[model samples]
Target: MNQYLNHLHVLRLLVQRELSSRYKGTIIGILWLFLQPLIMVIVYSFVFSVIMKVRIPGMDSSYHFALYLMAAMMPFFAFQEALISASNSLFANSSLLHKSTLPAILLPLVPMLATVITETIALVIIVIAAYLLLDQVSYYLLLLPFLVLIRLCLSLALGYVLAIMSVFVQDLRQALGLILTVILFITPIFYPVDMIPTELIPVNNLNPLYHLLDAYRAIIIRAELPGIGLLYMAGFSILLLCASVYFFQKTIERAKEFI
Candidate 1:
């Protein structure tokens, strides 16, 4: 128990360092945390919900699409942001890598936890707005914590691969940016899955984010439990996590050489 508590303290410092460094300089450092996402919420909500006027079948209120968009955006943002940050975590902290005997596995976690903390705050604001405007909240809202855990594991798995690869191939950093862009457009972020043609459903099924978003939407927008299919995806994430940890440990020793 004491050991676990000590790790928690270390984790806290890591997360704090990440936030501070990212926001270094400028007049409004930490406030940007609240302001930036809030600004994104307003801008995206305006562009899509107002100008583009997108709609989903299950949504009833005029703001329903915005609410749905925000709900889905919450997890996806964390997933993408955390994965990118985790991918760069090792290289970004190269100095720290040489410092001590701390577990390298813990490095990627800093960004994940930092982003989760920031997004959780944004999510609360959005959800409260959702409840106020729509007058409804899902019992599945209770499943949010579990969904977060799944997202963390999924990002961590991917992060392990990207972080190691990045040390060897500098181009990977830029390549990852383009890849994440393609992923964003491919995933049904701004649109509904049903909008896709029937023939493409098979292609859509191949995206892991597709299933994660579906399960997330079940609770966030529909107030329904995720289908049993979530179990399969959860299992997939577990396997990926185990494989990633092993790969990271094996290749990590050589990472410093490339860096």
Candidate 2:
């Protein structure tokens, strides 16, 4: 218990440093945390709603579409950022790792916690936007924290594994970039799920991210509880997180040698 507390203390310090350095010397500093996602939401709303003439069925306003996009994009952005940052955590902190006795797990954990802070800001913007645009936010929004917890678990599980492997495979960073792009398009963040082809529904359903974003839309847009599939995915993510920790502990010794 004392060891875990010590690790958590170390993690808190690392996360604080990571977040502070991210926007250091910038004029806006932490305001960029709120502005960054807000700008992305506005750009996406303009591109899809104005330039492309895209519209969500049964919803007349472009603002409504933006709300939908915000709900999905905020979480997806956090997941993507966490994975990419965590994947490089060891390499980026290689000098510190070599000189300190800190547990290597704390390196990847810093990014995960930092991503969560930014994500929380994005989520607050989503709530305020929904209340203003939609005229009322859902009571279901109360469940959002639980949903975010599931996403955190999923990110950490994948991140730890990727972080360790990335020490050995330099090309993984590029590969993950391309793969995340493909995933962003395929995951239905911009379009309604019904817009997907009928034949592909089963395959898309198999994607855990599809379920996660779907749950976000359900809570934010539809004012409904997430489906059973989300509950199942939550369970799976927790188990996967436990497994990834064991995997990281076992492989980190070898990974440190390479680093």
Candidate 3:
């Protein structure tokens, strides 16, 4: 427990440093936190609902398509930001890695936690606006914590593994960015899974992220129970966590030399 607390202390310092460096000379500064996602929601709303005219049938709630999109987007943005940030985390903090003797595993976690914390605050405002605009909040809203937990676990697991590999191969960051972009669209963030062709359903369902967002959609927009598949999602997250930590611990010693 003491060691865990020490890691938390180290994580806090790293988070503070990253936030400062990220917005150091910017004029608007942290305002970007709210603006970036808001802007994305707007752009996506325009492209998907307006231009593309994609239709989601089950979302007959008072919440419009925009609200539905934003609901799913909160976690997706967090996942994407955390994954990308975590991938480059070690490389970004090379100075700290070389000069400091803190737990090396905590390096990737700093950005993952920072992104999750900042995004969670932003999600609160978005959720309130969504509920107010749509109608009374649904009971499924309670599942939010579970959804967020799943996202964090998945991001951290993937981030830790990537961060360790990045020290050896700098180009992995670029490759990961491209892969994540493809995964984002492939995931049901902008569209509903039901719209997917029946034959292709299996392929799309293969992405664990699909089930994660579906769980949120069930509780928030649909006002229904999270499907039994959430157990599968939880299992997937646990497996990833085990694999990532194992790889990170084994490879971190070599990462120290490369950094």
**Per-residue lDDT of model 3, residues 87-177, tens digit only:** 7877777887788877778888888888777667656666665666566477777777777888899898888888887778889888987
Best by lDDT: 2
Sort the candidates on lDDT, descending order: 2, 1, 3
Q: lDDT of each model, Cα atoms only?
A: 0.81, 0.87, 0.78
RMSD in order of candidates: 2.0, 1.7, 2.6
Span of 10 residues, lowest total lDDT, candidate 1: 54-63
Task: State model 1's lDDT.
Answer: 0.81
- TM-score to true structure, per model: 0.91, 0.94, 0.87
Please write out the lDDT profile of model 1 over residues 90-114, one tens digit for every residue: 8888877879566787888789888
**By lDDT, is 2 or 3 better?**
2
58-130: candidate 2 lDDT, tens digit per residue: 8877677878888898999999999999889999999878888777778888989888889888888777777
